[model samples]
Target: MFASSLAVVLLTLAALLGAIVAFAWAWRKGHFHVDARAATLPFDDHDQRVARPWETPSQARERVQAHGPPLPPGPGEWGGA
Candidate 1:
């Protein structure tokens, strides 16, 4: 029982130490630094104007006002497999 408890404690400490080291390495390598452009890397022009079918005319107008006119979806752009 004592051996098992000690093993668990040692493993927990090792995992904690590993996480700390990984975080320090990432920090030193500037992995945490993010610019506005880099933050938008996953999105494109199409992502800016996705049509929401459920929106009422007023809601559509509000969306257009907030994000400019909505662009028509290209062929196969819909999630149909």
Candidate 2:
């Protein structure tokens, strides 16, 4: 029982130390620095204007005001069978 408990404690400490080391390494490598454009890499112009069905008229107007007119999705784009 004592041996198992000590093993658990040691394993936990090792895992914590590993996490700290990885975080420090990432910080030093500039991995934590992010550019604004990087956040939009996954989206294109069409994605920015696509209409959302769940939005109310006011919300839709707000979206249009912010992002121009919303484009309707192409046929089958809504995942119907």
Candidate 3:
């Protein structure tokens, strides 16, 4: 049991050290750099998608009748007020 516990602790420490080294290497290599081009990746020409408009009151009522009332807003959603 002592050997096994020591092995577990050593493995965990090694994994954490490896992660830190990798992060430092990436930082030196500018892997963490952010640019406007990277920010627009999701909006590239190949992936031009738009959100549909919100449901009207009548549509919302129909949805309630067909599929039960919509779920209440989850945590942090205040419905803009």
Candidate 4:
């Protein structure tokens, strides 16, 4: 049982490595060149471009309107509209 289980684990690891190599071979043949800027864009200064959190006064108005009218006080009466 020990030897069989070890063989199974080794086979699974070999298959996983083979899959990664196959992927890399295809990518290299296609000349995939991902630039450093593309990788860094998500962490760049997005705060500077947006200027404001929601961008405009209309957006703030929409957010304020989202918090319903008022809620009734009770276990069953929880409707905020």
- Please name the candidate that would achieve the greatest lDDT relative to the true structure: 2
Error of 2 at 20 (Å): 3.8
Worst ten-residue run, lDDT, model 2?
72-81
Give lDDT tens digits, candidate 1, residues 16-76: 9999999999989999876757876776767667667777989888868877889876666
Candidate no. 4 TM-score: 0.35
| TM-score, cand. 2 vs. native | 0.55
lDDT (Cα atoms) of all candidates against the true structure: 0.80, 0.86, 0.63, 0.56
Off by more than 4 A, model 1: 1-6, 17-31, 54-66
Error of 3 at 35 (Å): 1.4
Top candidate, metric TM-score: 2
- lDDT at residue 21 of model 2 (Cα atoms): 100
Question: By lDDT, is 1 or 4 better?
Answer: 1
**Which lDDT tens digits does candidate 2 get at residues 1-81?**
467988999999999999999999998999997777899898877877888788899988997897898999777655895
RMSD of 4: 13.6
Error of 2 at 50 (Å): 1.1
List residue ranges in candidate 4 displaced over 4 A: 1-3, 31-48, 52-81
Please list the residue runs of candidate 2 whose C-alpha ends up more than 4 Å from where it truly belongs after superposition.
Answer: 1-6, 21-29, 56-62
TM per prediction: 0.45, 0.55, 0.39, 0.35
RMSD of each: 5.1, 3.9, 13.9, 13.6
Where does candidate 3 stray beyond 4 Å?
A: 1-3, 36-80
How accurate locally is residue 40 in candidate 1, as Cα lDDT from 0 to 100? 68
Q: Compare candidates 3 and 4 on lDDT and give the better one.
A: 3
Would you list the clashing residue pairs of candidate 4?
A: none
Q: lDDT of model 3 at residue 1?
A: 43
